[model samples]
Target: MKYNKTYIFGITLVATLGGLLFGYDTAVISGAEKSIEAYLIRPLGLNSLIHGATVSSALIGCVAGGMLSGLFSNRFGRKKTLLISAILFFLSALGSGFPETLFFTKGEPSIGLLLAFNLYRIIGGVGVGLASAVSPMYISEISPAGIRGRLVSFNQFAIIFGMLVVYFVNWSIAYGQTIEWINDIGWRYMFASEAIPAALFGILLFMVPETPRYLVLSNRDEKARTVLTRINADRLRAESILFEIKQSIGRVTERSSIYSYGKVVIFIGILLSVFQQFVGINVALYYAPRIFESMGAAKDASMLQTIIMGFVNVIFTVVAILTVDKWGRKPLLITGSIGMAIGMFAISWLAYNEIIGISTLVFIIIYTASFMMSWGPICWVLISEIFPNKIRGQAVAIAVTAQWAANYLISSTYPAMMEYSGALTYGFYGLMALLSALFVWKMVPETKGKSLEEIERLWKK
Candidate 1:
């Protein structure tokens, strides 16, 4: 059946906005962490540990979001769940930007106000959490099998692009300001910038239809046929696709348990999520400027360096999107894992010798580029593809939840680990990267060129 490529692209673009917000909400903290530490932490006489907790508090909400995504998405539909996330994103952005405005006196320091700020950030994290799981799933279900990988990879591109956008916004905000001024007010503007995109996503989401799969699941066959024909451009082909979806789903009362798809499929999905985070990419993202400063780059120089890294991330993610369908998933994952291992190991060695120069920067770029190309995008593509439709909702929730938990564990423990030993801290991530390569090589099935229904049959074979 012939389909309208432009129409498909437009839907994909709108869905990936959720991905952009996911990236924006999470990485926005990188630029604001120092200000937060100065304004919220130091004022309260808190230590680095508390600062780490504060920085990662949003991830706690992420876990809750992921845990609840299956139930909410199953009940409310993906579009509505995403709409809910958009509202959360908007409110969190405004609240985080002006935490002291509501209750505390302006410029006054207190633990209560800090808690309020963390609460707002956590609310945004919940949005990130929901978007992270639902965005890719939505794209995958809607996209054609031939180009699904490419379309879903766009979500990853959006994630990195969002990070890049915020990096620029953060740098621009602080480009000429004194540290005193930046800490005083510049950070708030950085956080506030996200509100524009959040509002846009919410408004545009209303324009797109609910996914055909969800409509079919809910017994809205007429609506499902409408969406499918719009996407497929041939009523006969749309009906054929709908028939396949219905056959796969069976009766609604016959819902499969989480492990019904076969333990290997579920395990692989969880590991894909886990390894994506355990590779320590978030550490690079969440602390890009600080990592540079630790290498003796001044604050401004570190922001520039972080911006450079953000560009590298965006470029490599584009490479992944272009090649994911052509090159297949396992190859990219394995190759990227090897690249990350080498990069991480080299960085660990340099950090151990206290080498801070272009060499360290080069390795950081290599590591980030590898991740952006491989685990960064492919992991989401696979998770969205691997699960059987019946179990996809709950299964994705579990995998996404594990991913956020792993993200929090690695991100939260990073400062303490670095304090213990820079060599060991990065070396650990390097080791995980190596293991990730082996995991993909041994466990992950090749998913390219297979429809979601086709992929599900692999478990039985």
Candidate 2:
């Protein structure tokens, strides 16, 4: 059977725009967070908690969006749910940039305007939540069995690429600018830059066909057969594949719930999502510049360091894509977790000693790269593959919602944690990383080189 490589790649690329926007909206605030604190929080008589809340406000919407994903994706299909996410992304970007245009004067800080700004950021968060769950699921459903891990990993690549792009964008916006200007206007431009790609994602999404698995679920067998033919480029192979999918669906009765799939599978999925966030990955991302600044680097230099970290992230995510299917999931995850534990433990030592210099940077790079290569991408891949098809949408929604909720807890508490003891904070993450290695070893089943339906059968066993 000949493969339609270009056509499949094009469709995968389009679906990954959801991932690109996910990374963009989430990390854009990293560069602008301090400026936001200066302009909005301090002037309005707020404290660190409110500043943290405002910075992480999008996570609240993420929880809502993730919780709603099953209903939305199941009812509307993956492509349309992504379209809705893109619309939300577009609106959030513009609204966050000019939050005061409708209700308040420019440059005048008010509680009302502050509320409006958070509202917009949260809208963007909702978009992130939707994309985080649906994008990989969409990719997995369309991908061939042989290279599904590599292909779905492209979404992670897009995610890291998006983060790297925004890091550069944010740095460019702040470069050669005075602090006052960055506070008053530069941050707004940083927020607004996301609008361009958000619009692009929304546009291209219409060009891609719905996943064949989705078509099968909708009982459109002929349409499913057509899409599968194009993707597989073999009518006979497509029909066989379609039959297998139908067989899987037949096993699912209308009364099936998430538990019907298997308790262990759902537990593993939820735990995977939780451990991914609890290891403090997002804290590193959302507060990248601040972490660097705490190491005695100047503001601009800190942003520069953030860009460097973003670059490392992209490079290592590519490594993950190249090696995931080849090396298998367990080796990469366990290896990466060990690396993270080492880097974080070293950072904790340095922080306690008040030694902030080359060593700190090197350790931070190591930690970020380790995550990019392992848990960062592999976790998503497993989540997309592990659940039974009958319960995938709902199971993924529950796991992702837990993920965002954990993200909010870790990220929102980071400031206070840092203030109290940077040593303890980093040391704690290091411990989680070590524990994560053990958890993966004990609980996670490797899904490499398996069809989605085949992998689903593991839980039933």
For residue 392, what is the lDDT in candidate 1?
Answer: 86
Off by over 4 Å in 1: 102-104, 251-255
Q: Model 1 residue 257 lDDT?
A: 82
What digit string (tens of lDDT, one per residue) describes model 2 on residues 340-458? 99999999999999997989999999999999999999999999989888888999999999999999999999998998999999999999999999999999998988988898788
lDDT of 1 at 89: 95
Could you tell me the C-alpha RMSD of candidate 1 in Å?
1.1
Query: Model 2: number of clashes?
Result: 0
* Per-residue accuracy of model 1 over 1-461 as CA lDDT, tens digit each: 48879888999999999999999999999999999999899989998889999999899989989998998888999999999999999999998998886585675668888988999999998998899999999999998899999999999999999999999999999988998999989989999999999999999999998998888888898999999898989999899989989988883346578877668888888999999999999999999999999998999899999999989998999999899999999999999999999999999999999998999999999999999999999999999989988888899999999999999999999989899999999999999999999999999999999988899888757
The global C-alpha lDDT for each of the candidates, from Candidate 1 onward, is 0.92, 0.92
lDDT of 2 at 390: 83
What's every prediction's RMSD, in angstroms?
1.1, 1.0
